[model samples]
Target: MTRSLHDRHRAVLPDWLALYYREPIEITHGEGRHVWDASGKKYLDFFGGILTTMTAHALPEVTKAVAEQAGRIIHSSTLYLDRPMVELAERIAQLSGIPDARVFFTTSGTEANDTALLLATAHRRSSQILAMRNSYHGRSFSAVGITGNRSWSPTGLSPLQTLYVHGGVRTRGPYAHLSDARFIEACVADLEDLLGHTRDVAALIAEPIQGVGGFTSPPDGLYAAFREVLNRHGILWITDEVQTGWGRTGDHFWGWQAHADSGPPDILTFAKGIGNGMSIGGVVARADVMNCLDSNSISTFGGSPVTMAAGLANLGHLLEHDLQGNARRVGGLLIERLRAIGAQLPIVREVRGRGLMAGIELVRPGTDEADPQAAAAVLEAAREGGLLIGKGGGHDTSVLRVAPPLSLTVAEAEEGAAILERALRAV
Candidate 1:
C-alpha cells in the first residue's frame, strides 16, 4: 500500500517538495497528541504537523466552529461584511501591541509576509531590506529575496535588495566567542555599519526564534537594541511571528515580546497555528503603514467566515485554558530532560530553544562538523519507536526540531523523550 502511494505521490508532486523519513508514512487520523498512519501504526507527534496544530488534534472547539461555519457559509470574499472576520480582527488588534492596529488576513504565512513586504516598501519608499543571517520568512518571490538561508532559497532573483546581518544564531557566527552582552553589541554595531552603507532601508524583518533555521534564537534584548538604531533611520521593524506566535514560546504570547523593551514592532505577520488545522494567516500594522497603498485589494479566500470562525474558536480556547502557562511548565521540564540526555551523548553538540520548541544539533563526536548522517539515523530509529520528530539547520540539516502542541502533557513528553533517548543511543 505504501509503495503504490509513494509512486503516485512522486508522479504528482514536485521533486523539490520534501517528505520526512526514508519510508514515509501517510497520516490517516489524529486525536490529542497522537496520530495514526495508514498501516494503523500510532506515533506521538512532537512536531505537531510543523507546529501548525497549536492546541491539539481534532480539538472540539475548533472542529465545532469549523463545522457550524461550513454549515452556514464556507466563504464570502472581502467585498462583503464578515462578522467573524471583524470580531477576530478586533481581538487580534487589541492583543497586537501596535498602536491603532489594523489586521489584513491571508490564507497562508507566505501571503501574509508578501503583504508585509508591500506595506513596508510602500511606507518607507525603498526596496532594500535588512534581514538576519540564517533566517527564513517564506517561499514567495518577495519572501525568498529576504531569506538568508541559502538551502531553502531557490534563486537569487528577488523583488527586494536584501542585506544579511548577524546575531540570529548565538552559537554559530563570527561573534560566537563573545559574551551575551558583547554579542548583542556586536550585532547592533554590524547593523549600524551596514545601515551606513545603504540608503532608505525599508525594514528589518526577523524571527524572534528562527524557526526553519533550527529553532535558534538571538539574545533576549537583541531586537530592542536594533530597534533603537532602526528608529533613527525611520526604518520599519517587521517581526515574522508565523511559527512563534500564540504563546507557544512558554514565556510570552508572541516571541517578539522577549525584546519588548523598545515597544512593539512596526509590522507583524502570523500564521500556522491561529486557526488550528484551518488555513489562516494575516498581517497586523498601524493604520498609517497599512493604508499606504492607494489601489484596492482583497484576497478571495483570506478572512473567509469559515477560517475566521476557526481562528476565533482556537484563540478563545488557547487564552481561556492558559496553555501558555502549561507550555512554560511542561516545556521547561522537557528541555531540562533533553539537556541531560544530550550531555551523555557525544553526538549532541547543543540543545537549544525555549518553551515547547526545542532543537538538538548533532555533530561528529569530538569535532565541530555537522553530522547529518547521524541525524538521519536517529530520525528513522525514533520513527520505529513510535515517535515522530523533525529536522532543520543551516545547510547540513543537522538540527533535530521538536515542537509539540501547547497543550502537550508531561506524561506524553516523557514518553517521547524516552523513545528519543533510545534512538540517539542506537545512532
Candidate 2:
C-alpha cells in the first residue's frame, strides 16, 4: 500500500521534498508517543514529526479544541476580530520577554521568519543580516538567504544580504579546542571585527539551538555576550525558537533563556509544536519594531479560529501540566542514557541536547569525519526495530535527532533509548 502511495507521491511532489527511510511507511494513526504505519506496525516516535508534535499525537485537549472551533467557525481571515486569536496572542505577549510586545501570526516557521526579516530590515533601514554558521532558519526565499547550512539553502538569490558568523557549533569549529569562555571570546571578537567591515546590519538572527544543524548549541552565555556588542550598534537580536521553544530544551522555558543575562531578544519567532501538529507560527516583537511597517499586512490563514483554538488549548495544557518541568526531568535522564550508549560505540562522536531534544552525531570509527552513511544505516535499522527517529547535520546529515513529545514519559524514553541502542549496534 505504501509503495504505490510512494510512487504517486514521487510523481507529484517536489523532488526536493525528502522522505525518511528507504521504504517510507505511511503513518495511518498515532496515540501518545507511538504511531502505526499502513502495515499496522507500531513504532515509538522519537523525532515527533521533526519536532512539530510538541505535545503528543492525538492529544485530546488539542483535538477537542480544534473540533469545537471548526464546528463553530474554521476561519474568518484577519479582517474580523477573533477571540481565540486575541487570547493566544495575549498569552504569547505575556510569555515573550519583550516589553510592550506585539504579536503577528503566520502559518509556518518559514512565514514567521520571513515576517521577522521584513520587520528587522524595515525598522533598521538595512537589508543586511547576521546569521550563525550551521544554522537552519526556514525555507522561504528570505529565510534561505540568512540560513548558513548549505544543504538546506537552495538559492543564492535573496532579499537580504546576510553574513555568516561562528559559534553555533561548539565541538567542530576553529575554536573547538578552546574552553567555553575562550570560545565565546573568539566568536565575540569575530562578530566585532565583522561589524567593523559592514554597515547597518538590521539584525543578528540565530536559533538558540541550531535545530536542523543537529541540535548543536553554543555556550550558555554566548548570545548574551553577543547581545552586549549588538547593543553598541543598535542591532536587533532575533531568536528563532521554532524547535526549541515551549520547554523542549529541559533547562529553560525558551532556549534563549540559557543566555538570559542580557534579557530577551528584540524579536522572537516560533512555530512547530505550539499547536500540536496544527499549523501555527508567529512572531513577537517590541511594539516599535513590529509597527515599523508603513503599510498593512495580513495572513489569510494565519490566525484562523481553528488554529488559534488549537494553540490556546495546547499552550494551556503545556503550562498547566508544567510540561517544561517534565521536559527537564525526563530529558536529563534520556540524555544521560544516550551518553552512556554513545560511550562504547566507535561510530558515535558526541551526544548533546537539553530537555526533550537531543542529537547523537555519527562519525567514522577511527576518525573525526562525519559519517552520513552510518546515520542512514542506523535510521533504517531503527525503523526495522519499530522505532522512528530523524537525521540532520551540516552538508552531511550525520546526526541522529531524538526529540519526542514534551509529555514523553520516563518509560517511553527508556524504551526509545533501548531501541536506539540496538539500532546503533546493528549499524
Candidate 3:
C-alpha cells in the first residue's frame, strides 16, 4: 500500500516537494510526543513535523478550540469582524516587543515574510535587501529571492536585489576560527564594507537560527552588532522567527533576544509552532511600517476563525504549562546525552543547538567534508529503531535536526537519545 501511494505521489506532486526516507511511511495519527505510521509502527517524533507540531500531537486545548470554532465558522475572509482573529492578534501584539505594534495575519511563513518584504520595500522606497548566508526563509518567489542556499533556491531572478551577508552559519563561513568577539566584529565589518558598495537598501532580514541551514547560528549578539550598521543606513531589521519562536530556543521566547542589546526588531515574522499545526502565520511591526501601504489589503484565508482559535489555544497551553521551562530542562539533558554519544562517533562532526532545537552534523571520518550519505544512513537506521528525526543542511542535507515537542519529558528525551545513539552506531 505504501509503495502504491509513493508511486501515485510521484506521479502527481511536484518533484521539488521533498519527502523523507527511502521507503516513505504515511503517518496516520499521533499523540503526545509520538506518532503511528500506516504500518502500525510507533516512532518517537523528534522533529515535530519540521517543528510545526509544537506543543504535541492532538493537544487537547488546540483540538477542542478548533473543533468548537469549526462548528461556528471556519472562515469569512477578512471583510467582517472576527472575534478569534482579533483576540489572537491582541495577544500576539502584546507579546511582540515592537512599540505600538500592528499585526497582519497570513497563511504560512512564506506569506508572512512576503508581506514583510512588501512593507519594508514600500516604507523605505527601496527594493534592495540584505539576507544572511545559508538561510532558508520560505519557498515563495519573494522568500526564495532572499534565500542564500543554492540547493533550495530554484532561480536567480528576483524583484528585490538581495545581497547575501555573513554571520548566519558560524562554522562554515570565513570567520569560523575567530573568537566570539572577533567573529561578531568580522561580520559587522563585512556588513559595513558591503553597505558602502550598495545603493539604497530596504531591510536586513535573518533567521535567529538558520533552520534549514542545519540549525546553524552565529555567536550570540552577532545581529546586535549588525543592527548598528543597518541603523546607520536606515535599513529595517526583520527577524524571521518561524522555527525559533515560542520558547523552543530554551533561554528566550523569541530568538531575536539573543541580540536584545539592539532592542526589538523593526518587524517580526512567525509561523510553524504558533498554531501547533493549524497553518497560522503573521507579521508584527511598528504601526508606521505595518501601515505603509496605501491601498486596500486582505487575505482570503488568512486570520480565519478556525486557525485563530487554534493559535489562541495553542499559545495559551504553551504558556500556562510553561513549556519553555520544560524545553530548557529536558532539552539540556538531551543535548548532554547526544554530545556524549557524538564524542564516541567519528562521523559526527559537531553537536550544536539550544534547548529542544539541536543539530548533529555528520562529516567524513577524520575529514571536514560533509557526509550526507552517513546522515541518510543514520536517518534510515533511526526509523528502524523506532525514532523519527529529520535531516537538513546547506551541505547536501548533512545535519540531523532533533526538535521534539516543547512538552518533551526527561525520560522521553533519554529514550530518543538512546535510539539515536544506536542509529549512529549502526551507520
Off by over 4 Å in 1: 1-3
Model 2 alpha-carbon drift over 4 Å, by segment: 1-3
Tens-digit lDDT track for model 2 on 1-427? 4559989999999998999989989999999999999999999999888898888899999999999989999889999899999999999999988899999999999999999999999999999999999999999899999999999999999988999999999999789999999999999999999999999999999999999999999999999999999999999999999999999997888899999998999999999989899999999999999999999877899999999999999999999999999999999999999999999999999999999999999999999999999999999999999899999998899999999999999999999999999999988
- TM-score of every candidate: 0.99, 0.99, 0.99
Worst 10 residues of 3 by lDDT: 1-10
Estimate the TM-score for candidate 2: 0.99
Query: Please, what are the lDDT tens digits per residue for candidate 1 over residues 99-147?
Result: 9999999999999999999999999989999998999998899999999
Clash count list over all predictions: 0, 1, 0
Q: Local error of candidate 3 at 226, Å?
A: 0.8
The lDDT of each candidate is 0.94, 0.95, 0.94
